[model samples]
Target chain A: MMIKRLTNKLLMGIIIFHILALSLLPPFTFTEVKAAADSPGFIIQADWVVGKNMTPSIVFTETSGSDKTPMLRVHYEEAVIYGMKLTKQFSTPSGPVSLTLKADGPVRMSGMTVDTSSLSFKGACLRATENIPDAGLEDVTMVVHYMNAGGSNIEQLSLQTVDGNQGPAKPKKTQILVDLALLPYTQALKEVEKISSGKKPLVCDEPVADEGDVKPGEPKASIPDELSREDLVPGEEVIEDRVGKVTDPVTKVIDPATGVIEPVTGITDPITDPVKDIVKPVEKVIKPVTKPVKKVLKPVTKPVKKIVKPVTKPVKEVVKPVEEKLKPVTAPVKHALSESCKRVKDTKGKITKDLGLDLIDQALKEGKTLPELCKGDASLTRALEDFEDGLTDILGLDFIFKALGQDEEAKLKRMKETLKNQKDNFIISL
Target chain B: MEEREQEVQVRSGFSKKAFWTSLASGFLLLGLLLVSFGISGVACAVPIAGVGDFYVKFDQLEGTGYTFYPKLGETSSSDSSPQGTNLIKDVTIKNLQLYKDFKVGGDTIRVLITASKPVRITGLHHDAGLIQANAKFQNLTLKENNSSNWQKQFEQTSSKITLENAKLKTHYLFQETINMAGMKLTVEKIK
Candidate 1:
């Protein structure tokens, strides 16, 4: 059949020339992983450290105990440190030395790794206060001064809560975390899980009472004011025991059958050392030893028993003074918030549920006013004239023209009554 | 035979008119042999009388540079001439014609005359100063009292005459004359 129709037109032109050579290739791929951070791993390049408080120093990479805790965040409204001075006078162990550290205000370093394991520090600049109010921001310090090489000691760190959105609907960046081994701090507070798990050392959760109970290493007995007939030291004395290693907590006693520690000397019956393996037993069991109680005499003023025995200190005096009675300042709430103005939109609950009242609409419509629609935010023009007078007392020009015309008023009222009847039949035929 | 066939039929009628008259006499003898060579090329172009006559004959003769200047410019030497040595042998002059004269004081002026070399005069006579000759050769025959005593001694010849095979006949005049008898000059005045 003509060679099978020339092999089916050469297999349909080799399957359309391999689909036009795979549709001219190129699908997706990428590279440039890092480098090009728009340049600047360290560059003060030029600086005078303004009004001179110029403290220049450099050195960081010494961490210990949990690799010396310090995740990144160095926020800066200030910073400044430039240096050079070593023209061959290099002495160290706390003496003369200077070579690099160059910093300038808006510093960086957050969670490190813009290469060379990041957090690199070096002095001055800091600044950032301006519109304050995040509940009046309590702490923001920065200081970092170690001045002459080994003259190490001025690290004031602590300004870290700036993660991501610092608000008015978010976009101004900040991140701040510092700790570089706490060198010169000026305010500090950590425990956001120990500086976000840079690892362990924030401890203190409360555990106090072991000093007076004394059961850790035992030793006590010295009550001999001339033993009365009742001191009973007759031949009826019976004492058989053997245990050791009690370095005096008023004369030892901890022998759970030969696990040894028993120094009992003329005891009055107050022995406790069930082994806590010595070592200053709670500062030697709060010292003051010399005990002797055993009298059964009646009280000098007791007519009868006036017992108040349910005293668990009256339930720890009513649950420990309600835990130091504090927490009460109030008034900073502000929450109804279902969506702040990011770019904008509120419409005050669809104009106060169609005119019942109490509103605040303004998501910028074009009828102007409100200082002509905040013409460049002179601080949002008094919240846009109190949201345009709360949306004109909540929609009343007939519910703002029926919520601005329920679907365009019946085809614009039949095209305005057919152009008003053709202008009244052309003014009654003119 | 009937009189020998009438003499063979009158000699075959004279041999058939003599074979048609010998073929018209062989085309009239080949047209008279082409008119006898075109009459011998017109008789070889005439002239056979003396055929460019060339001759040398001598008789008593004498010659010298002859000059005779008489009038008043008088100094004369008679003979040293050899030009044409006075040639007269059969007197042949093929051409020449000349006439000149100048005798200032006694008035006889007619100067300038010229022609020479192609000539045939035979006889001539001129007066009023020269050239009167008769029976002159170049072919001649003259008489009449020998041309009247050679025209009266050519008017008492007083000097220039050079006529050869001459011709100048103002009616053989006796006055008013200017003649060049084939370059034999003559000029005359008779008042």
Candidate 2:
């Protein structure tokens, strides 16, 4: 009766313990899902690929809009377009002419479009170059199409050979055709294609009815409700199976006598056995030889150590006071030097502030001339002179001037002469 | 009788030639003053404040430009170097007006620049308050600040370089020759 009672108690204890352990374990083990990487801001593809240096002409087609005023707009988000070129080819009276338009620097376009059967660029100066092989025509007329506030319009503009000294005239119009091959193949486009091909599931499609124990006329199980039910119902049998599988391998490898795993023992025994065998024999051979040597050295070293300690203690004691005594003497001198330096720095700041050197600096950065800066302030002039003198001294300008005396004079004279001759080009007025 | 004789000698000492020469000299001095005043007036009349394009090419330009020196008890390795280069630092200015335009060479390019604040070229001596313009550069190369061959590389000629609304500060600028067109310089007192 007592044995039966003890067995029941043990069984109950095991069940209670498992309940507590299961409650303490996490409810769900969620797998982390990584987000997709961001796509590029925009991509440009041209129909006719050429050398990397040469920018191919691009035609943007209107994809979505009303039939009457079809428009395609691209917002660059103030991004600078580097090495942008616009090329137009036409059969002129002379021959087939290719006119390429390029900006002097990177073009910053906020929003633009190559649609409405016209090409219009705003807020940028473009220079045009023509490739005329025969040189048969000094000028050519080309029909240009452009868009404005009033909508797209066509204009005939004349193109003249830019003078060598003058700026190039603006090009008015060029005809452009849509190239279907250059459309960007993005993920959104793929989704659109799937939707158009009747492959994607529609919202109106009915859900598959659940089979088995669900009764008729009762509220159907929604996706979230079903998921919640599955999550709440813990897989006790599966957990127990996994735990059994994990322990089975461990139990097979473990040694009953040592409680060490047999695999670990197998790995370490070969390496440790050879080392132990070699060390035991060497230790036995070295023991007698080392013992006599240790005994002899210990007696000899004791007297020398005793003698050296006494000598070193006295020397250290003597040097300590000297070092202490010198510290006070040297500290005041160091402090005085630092103090003087601080004072000099303070004075320099005061002087710079007093003479409005900072103001002069500000004015100079604002593009003010030195003469204008020092016009009324005599103190400022003196300060500037002093500053210049200091710089001159540091750079050793006196020596440089002495070395390049005549040459320097001649250079200055020539510069003045050149400036005077180009007086119309160099005007300074206020 | 002696006073009357002294008066007579004084009158004779003042001859017609002396009188005419003195009068001519006075008129010449007056003319010189008027001419100088007119020249100065013309200089002040032409204002450099206007929206226009400018271009300059330095075939050969030579100047100390701007120089900066390290302060007392400071090493060159410290932040005292100009434009991150181991060059001297002397003066700092907020605004400087520079204007000029003329062509000495063939095929000139024009630039118009405007800006809110002055565009300062530190290593270069030239200064401008603000610039807003279209600019073009050809065959421009910038040498590294720490390079030992900076001076030699700088001496090599460049085709062109255009900067707009740029605050450029350099150690020094020395060009052998220059060509400029449509340049204007303006200097005004800060209110």
Candidate 3:
């Protein structure tokens, strides 16, 4: 009975210990419990696994590291892989040419086995290695390391097997139908095709028939030796007569040089002659009345003049010295003010030159009116306005015009003239 | 006779108490074992680490509505064609195999892949990469620019592009929109 009790305690202790040990052991030891299917699959071990639009059915192999959960299956449906590189050395006529192909596109795969210590989805590390449901990721970029040797055109490429053997004895025939627009270098290809097919040259040397030339056996209508206004229209002669009569007087009145209208040379003579005859009778009647009034005013003016002359002379004498005394003080002040204004102008000139504002000013000086320079250029107009405002703040409205060696009123007048000319041209041109 | 009966009763009572204790302990052990199995099952669900170098191969590959940009720039003198965005309507590959090689001690460990069916992808956009392939075109057209300032001398287009017994290699292959049929994998070691 003592031995049975001892054995029971010992067995319990052993069972507890075994359970603890089994629990402590890594879970990978039990992977045999869930056997993977025997089917066609792929295994890829990349230093870095980065992709997107991945709906992959992936299985993870056991690995050692802090990351306990490794991605087992990913159903990367439409995944974009970035920076995938492959290189091969080929024997060419020149020498050995190393060719490297880099690709980035949507990849489709089936039965793929991915092995990586680090696997991330959308840049975040997967915490667990389980069947990742549809991981529809977009824009997964990766970095690949490789070397580039030199240039090898795709046209120069030749078939080679995995064992690096040359072209096959009997090449398989394949046909690809492609749209012309989808292909690159379309125009170049068309030209080559044209040349190879011996098509007609784009530029032909054949002489073209003139539209005015009359062909053999074709009837030609006779043309009149001269064109007549009366033949073209029945009332054209009368219209010409009326038009000439109206234009003759207008031409005589308008001065060509000034583009201004002047009265016809003899137009005012008849009116002036009639006015002179009427004025002669009226003048005779008014003469006697005017003579009496003038005699009455002459006596009153003499006395007043004598009294005012003495007072004005004394006032003028007193003001002369005061004016002379103030000249010395005011002259230097005016000179200093002018000098400061000139200095400000000079500083502004420098700033304008640095800012390229001087180019506009130069163009203005070159006879480009403000309107002409600012036409079709809103930014230039705004810049000029801003510059004008800056000058107005520092000096005054007329300062910029003065600095340009022109009067503000003259500049405005010129601008108006330019605008008027432009408007007139716009109307006439249409 | 009375003393012997009392001793027998005490011994029976002790045995019954010991039996109950043993039975309780056995139940506790079973519960602990179940809890441990549950924990391990959860752990196993986590991703296993991967081993090896990157390698992939396909028996046949086909793509539709393909477009590629050479990005040769605007000048005629520039010969360097950089990678740009490329597009395809859909793509399919048959008998696909991929392998990742690893060095364990002196031997190389890799995943061996058998034959597989077709993998399909739709609406693929390729951003950048270089590709080398043997190709031939039918009804090809070539246009030339003779301008002194032009960097590229000629441009080409074709009604059809046929690649037979052609080997295509790529560097930096990044893509999108993929689907694969069956998958089978096995690991192998080589010295």
Best by TM-score: 3
Q: For each candidate, report its DockQ versus the true two-chain complex.
A: 0.00, 0.01, 0.04
* TM-scores of all predicted structures: 0.14, 0.17, 0.21
The TM-score, computed over Cα atoms with residue i paired to residue i, of candidate 2 is 0.17
Q: In model 3, what lDDT does residue A165 have?
A: 20
Q: What i-RMS does every model get?
A: 87.3, 24.5, 23.7
- When candidate 1 is compared with the true two-chain complex, its DockQ is 0.00
Off by over 4 Å in 2: A1-71, A77-80, A86-430, B1-191
For candidate 2, what is the DockQ-based docking class? incorrect
Local accuracy of candidate 2 as per-residue lDDT tens digits, A1-77: 99999999999999999999988977542211100111101112122111111111222231111112211222121
CAPRI verdict (incorrect, acceptable, medium, high) for model 3: incorrect
- Measured on C-alpha atoms, candidate 3 has an lDDT of 0.34
Compared to the true structure, candidate 3 yields what TM-score?
Answer: 0.21
lDDT of each: 0.26, 0.28, 0.34
**Model 1 segments more than 4 A misplaced:** A1-27, A30-73, A81-195, A199-382, A385-430, B1-191
lDDT by residue (tens digit), candidate 3, A85-183? 333322322332232333332222222223222222222222122223433322222111110111111232322112132221211111111122234
